[model samples]
Target chain A: MEQTLRRRQPGETVFGYALLLLGLFVMAEGYRIDGLYSPSSAGVFPALAGLVMTVSALAIIRRIHRMRPAHIPEGSGTAREFVRRTTPADVAVMAALMLAYMLALEPVGFLGASFAFLFLSIFYLHRGGLLTALLVSTGSLAAIWVVFRVLFTVVLPSGWLFR
Target chain B: MSDSLSYFLMAWTDPQLLLLTAAGTFAGIYIGAIPGLSVTMAASILISFTFSWDVNPALALIAGVFMGGVYGGSRSAILLNIPGAPAAIATALDGFPLAKRGEAGVAIGLTTVCSFLGGFVGIAALAIAAPAISEFALLFAPRDYLLLAVMGLLLVGSLSGESLAKGLYAGALGVALGMVGMDPMTAEGRFTFGTVQLLGGIPYVAAMIGFFGVSEALAQLHNLKAPRIKQDVSRILPSWSLLRRYLPLSLRSSAIGVVIGALPGTGGDIAALMAYDQAKRTVKNPSRPFGEGAYEGVVAPESANNAAVGGAYIPMLTLGIPGDAVTAVIIGALFIHGLKPGPMLMIETPHLFWFTVGNLTLANIFMLVFGLSGIRFFAKVVETPPGILIPLILILSVVGTYAIQNSVVDVYWMLGFGLFGYFLRIYGFQVGPVVLGMILGPLMDTSYRRAMISAGDDPVAFAQEFVTSPLSLVLALAVALLVISQTPLWRGIRARLAGG
Candidate 1:
């Protein structure tokens, strides 16, 4: 059967170009490590991988160029549509919350950080009210604590603040 | 022989092991049936939780999970038309149609029985074939190992994602990531840039959790509002006549599953697809038109994918090469337990082999019991909105990452990779090759270095050895053929041949 070409996703071209740059940087790093001293040099395999990456990235760009652009809905700019389609408000908020949770894991500890992140994110995503989110998050946190900390004996961070 | 039998029955006879196996299988079913939650993600996370336990218990739980997870994917596929895992993508084709026709119960029952049968075939193959393969694998040289790794990566890249280039890019990127930290051979930092943390290399478990777990959760955001479809299921147990009728097709699909699953880098997803395709072509008269709702359609994929569970283990146990993504993660678990997977693994720890075989057999039994009994509960479970599930998964990802060595740095790595992996997914790139590449990268590097050193660092001599030795020649040819087949020239030639 003939393969169908899917409409190119928004930001695909830019992503391809970014990957290409990464490949080039890696290639340069590979060269910096060892200047093609020998086939068995520490840098050789990495260099080969970088070269493959570079070549593939260029191929990806070429393929992307052949595809038609995505159809933006009426009354929406392409850039705005791209962001909305790829990373909607909920996703963006969740991502930001994830970043906060990770940063707070040490200072705020697993329990505090996780509870807050879970409750807030669930409340935001679920939109079913705050009390339910609080109950769910708390129950979940307790279950996780019991499972990992108590039963499995994993040493979760106690937080310097708590100490 | 008697000792092997004893080991094979170990899980069945032991109470703790039996309970763990049953529990793992039960959990695995739910995991596999839930959309956005995958066997690979669950297995990777489970490894961290189980890391400190005895190797036997750890293996038992993981084995159950592996067996159950493969079969469980069909549950959601049948009920919701959303494949719980990639392996059940084909199952959803006819499974959902059957559900729509109010034969959801019958469909699930047939799928459960066939999956059980296929699981048996796979285990039987593993029991019979792995030791023999391990013996042969013992004769492999470093060059041959390199060729095998290359072949695996090439197959994974070409078979998955939108384009070969994208696959290759993801794979090479993984190889590059694997090269980070200290050079295993010389203890010199390769990509550290003088950073003390970089010297330890990126923790692979972190990478696995991020790429598979976090990235998947982020991707699920796209379909957060997709309405859940409800189906009433009744009478899940298939009649004996129904079983006898589909037995031949299930067996045939199971055979296909074993061969495809045993191939390194490929897994149940591909096996199920091929089996479904094969069934479409071969089965002369179906209960219905191939797509409209055929019993064979559901039977082929479910059976094949479950059978693939056994097929996937053969390479990981015998050659230290993963048959697919889950096995790749399992390899990490094996390493953590101080067990080396390869030919020596079989020779040194023969009991582990038999115990696994037995455990998988037991898991299959549990899969059958759980799969048939819990249709109503499973329907409700699949309806659990991604809104709640995603947060839970994120929390699990964090805990799973932290559990591995309790390193905050690894958690950061997980987050970073997760975000990057999400973008990669959006761009139509598969993250499977990236993880597979990471696992195989160091193996390829060390193998290449060893092969080169043996040839006195002469590129020509190293190249010459590929063809001079019989084993290496076969592997070299296989690799070359794999690469060539992905090229435009090969496609053009094949098209010409087909047209004429």
Candidate 2:
């Protein structure tokens, strides 16, 4: 049987450059303000940080440019396989879940929103039968609720539904 | 001595306190046994529950949890390849290999005993060294703290994944993240970007949960289809001869743990890894090399991390500065209960110091009892589907984050970090340096700026002062040597010198 070869993709290099560009932009924004105690003064550290990041990114880019791409394992044939090795789909799912969480947190109340978020996230990750997901999510939510609400006496968002 | 004995007796007589200690121990083991949950998180959560309680009970509960959580992480690291916390990363190297060979029970049992021994030694050191160390710590000016922070940042070279430069970048990024909240000196907003939530700055706990907890869950999803783990749970205890053999190594590791723990900003995770590395170097005879089911590997790390709990308290009780994030939260508890920690704390509140010592001793004993009893049940949790566990962790992370201030903003920040952290991990970036950077950044920044001001903006004066101080000079030389050892030219020269 013939083995398929794998190589580092250009897209990965592009992604690195994109991060560097974003960091540079942020650094530029940070430098725009000048005041000792002004509201705008917070930008100084971020600006300095962004500059550092940009330099590091450039170094990484140079290093990557000089390096030979890695060979794919035998029996795996195709660019798709190589991409799978590098980029995990879960990253996208996790990103989406976080976005949903941020958007829904205020509207849904801490308890209701967190419970739903937990359920969906578990389902996505576990891909288990509904019963298992429900049992786990419900148990986790109840434990959290008891700790925060009953024990700590901290007020969580009630949302319009609870109110 | 008599006053300390009475405090110890009072702690022993109080059954409720004993029970809390026991519960905290059991809970900490389970928390540590689970991959992704950390002792620090467990302690942080316990703080909220104990917030309104009296200082003694609150300290007892947090102390119990702290001891338990540190030992608990080794459980998962041994039984499964997954490390329950960063402290257990070194443990997992040898621990998982032993489990794969069907000696999971023995590995765990030995870890439990070593953890107990380590905790005791750490407390013993703390009880003896804290007064003297606190006195020394009192002499530390802002300039000294700045130097300490720089020394810590140097660890980036060791911790960075594959590339040292990358690690420095990650660490610098973390320090910047730490800079996001309110500026300490000016009380001015530096990075809030005009948002009310930004005024308070980023919460460390949220970033921690996202970085360690949420990021691990995301990574686990990639390998969800791996085969379920199976093991016999009957042979949990190590033979007497096995215990006798590793006793010296455990003691040495515990000493390392205490020393590392005493250093401000350093914690158990670093201590454990360094101890493990040192053990590999020092111990000549082994049934096998480390990371291949070596008993010394497990014993060294388990002992060191547990001992770190005692080491951490030395600074907390002596100086006002917290040794780690969990201790920082405990500092908040202390302040709320009308107690302040610092040099004068010993003079003003001797009983408080004794109470802490008593509490730590009790927490360690409870950890021993609880750690040995529940091997079978926790092993079963490994079989629980990731779908269930991951979501459950997320829920806890959210509730835990929100409970900090009951603010939805923290939850948002946590989720954002969680997403960012997941991507960072996928691209071979390490998350540990970032957390270390965030925690230590402000300390570095404030102290450096303050040191400059104190020196009248004269760089030469600052240099002269550091050189004149015996301790600072030693520390400066150590930093210089550490930097030199990392350079390619230094390596070549050292190799040549050795050859000659």
Candidate 3:
């Protein structure tokens, strides 16, 4: 059995819809403030921007459909295919870890939160070296704390734990 | 004349001042080479530390940092594909590709020398033609400024990666984002959605770091184990023949830099992009095609941005208006020193003007010395393992974003844009236009509205003003040419003309 090489681009449909929704929302927001009747009104520029965005998004959708038949296979699990193609598992994990770091930041303090985040990230990426991760994370956080707090006099968040 | 001569040579004679200037320039180059650390940030930080010192020493250090930082931004741009500051955005376009091909050292060396040459041109203008240039800058009307902003946005056509439509959408999106916050004209909220923090709008600095720094970090996670490129450090200094060849282009870009930098609300970023665009249109046979490691691409932006340092001072010393953020900080320093910066400044404190020119001259010389010597070391720095470098970049992005206003919310915005920008990059959209839009969007909006209001709500009157005013008409014609140059018809005509 011979398999043909198929050229496919990812996320056009998703991107187009996202942009369309954003354009409509922005347009509605513009109207809610000031009606678009007056060109010099506060809403005029934003409304025009929304209109351009919406039109461009429609064009993107049209372009995607025009190009899709030759590339993306028409079959089951298409959404899964897009997910796999667009967001590989490694990237998703890193992104999730970043979000987690942000959330834990204020509560855990700069040093506390940053150290943990750094260590976990480095260790995971380095494939689990306990001592190196421990040393690397601590040293990096210390350098930052000294530079920002002691030298520059910036008051970084102490968080509940450290202060 | 002799008093002015004494002022010009003062820094060279004073040991403390010369030492401070040299130290400041050296630190600035390193700080500027680091991702997420900008010249503006360093200048602002120095203001606090140097507050108690005498004004002359403070000014010398800040001036050195200013010159060094502007040139330093290109180091990271060439080596890492991450712009150290907004002004270096254009530098990274072709600089990164050159680095990937192991030509990073030559790129760095060429940009450094061009930057020095450009700096000299800017200083020459600052010294000789400052008064006349400032008077000319004052002649620009609101409509003219609007045309300039539009002209900048027009470059999105060239910078847009694969699709013009995608670029337009991104640019419009950026414009809309910039429109958020209270309308400066009235107290009316435009896109605030009742948020108090957003009353000031999204910080473009944070947006810059996220799009270029954090987003690039996220993108790097895909090939975390990919082999790093080894930069060639053998030919670090550019040859005299290469310098001789591009001398005309360098001088033209420096002039453009000075003019744009002297304009209020414009800065090195705009000048760099404009110069890069000009090079693209004019250089019929480039060493390489642009966005693919063209030497002209690196030279045009690096030279323009550094020259902008001197150009920025032109307005501050003459008109009391700041040319850029760093210059604005300098204005504050001047105020602290009990000197007012304006037209009166040139006459009343001629010594200050001459002193600044001399100081910048010394800084530019130091910039050349420091910029050329560290190429091999800089190349080795960029070869850090991705596993180490990527996380380091993300941390620096967060820290830099937070440092802007000490606002955690800004960090969140950086992360948000980082994720969004990562997706955009994956989809073949260049992140440059988005940042370009964010930077230029507010300028465009405010200028357009002001120009409209000046016309008393008369659309025809407002439109006519573009053709009626000589300066506006010139800008209008430039904008028209920019549009025509982007069209297929113009390309076809040019091709046919060349064939004939």
lDDT of 3 by residue, B1-500 (tens): 99999999998899999999999999889878888778888898889889889989999999999999999989999888898887888999999999999999889999999999989989989999999989999998877888887787767545547655677778778888888888877678888878787799899888988899988988888787788888998998989999888888998899899999989878898899999999988999999999999999988988898888889999999999999989999999889878899999999989999999999999999999998897888898679777666777787788778888888889899999998898888777778778877777777877787888889878899999998898999999998997677556777888889899
Encode model 2's per-residue lDDT on B1-500: one tens digit a residue: 89878776556679887777777777777766654356665666677677788777778777887888888878767765556666776787788788777777888899999999999998998888887755665677776776766666655434335455566667777877888766777676666777777777688767877776677667777777876657667877878899999999999999989877776776787778767866876899976887688999899989998888888888988888787666787888888889898777878988888878888898898888888887887676566676676666666666667766677777777777776777677666777667767777787777766766677766688678789888778878867876676666776886789899
User: What share of the reference contacts is kept in model 3?
Assistant: 0.54
Model 2 chain A worst lDDT run, 10 consecutive residues? A1-10
lDDT by residue (tens digit), candidate 2, A1-163:
1113234453556656876886686577557534323322445556766787788778767666665565556776546654565446765676677678757777788767877787787778877777767877788778777755775565777777556
- Model 3 C-alpha lDDT versus the unseen true structure: 0.84
User: Which candidate number would show the highest TM-score if scored against the true structure?
Assistant: 3
**Across residues B1-500, which tens digit of lDDT does each residue of candidate 1 receive?**
99999999999999999999999999888768754456786788789789999998998898888888888888877876556676786787789788767678889889999999999999998998876643554577888878877876775576546888998999899999999988888787888899998988898768867886788788878888877545556677899998999999999999888877886666887678778867876898999987678999999988899888898899999889898888999999999999999879989999999999999999999998998897877656445677787898789888877876788888889888989999998888877678768877898999999999999999999999998999899989877877888788888888999999
| Alpha-carbon deviation at A67 in model 1, angstroms | 2.9
Clashing pairs in 2: A6-A72, A42-B190, A126-B387, B181-B201
In model 1, the Cα lDDT at residue B66 comes to: 85
Write the candidate numbers in order of decreasing DockQ.
Answer: 1, 3, 2
Worst 10 residues of 3 chain B by lDDT: B156-165
Off by over 4 Å in 1: A1-10, A70-78, B1-115, B125-131, B231-360, B375-379, B494-498
Model 1 pairs in collision = none
Model 1 TM-score relative to the real fold: 0.78
Task: Flag the better candidate by DockQ, 2 or 3.
Answer: 3
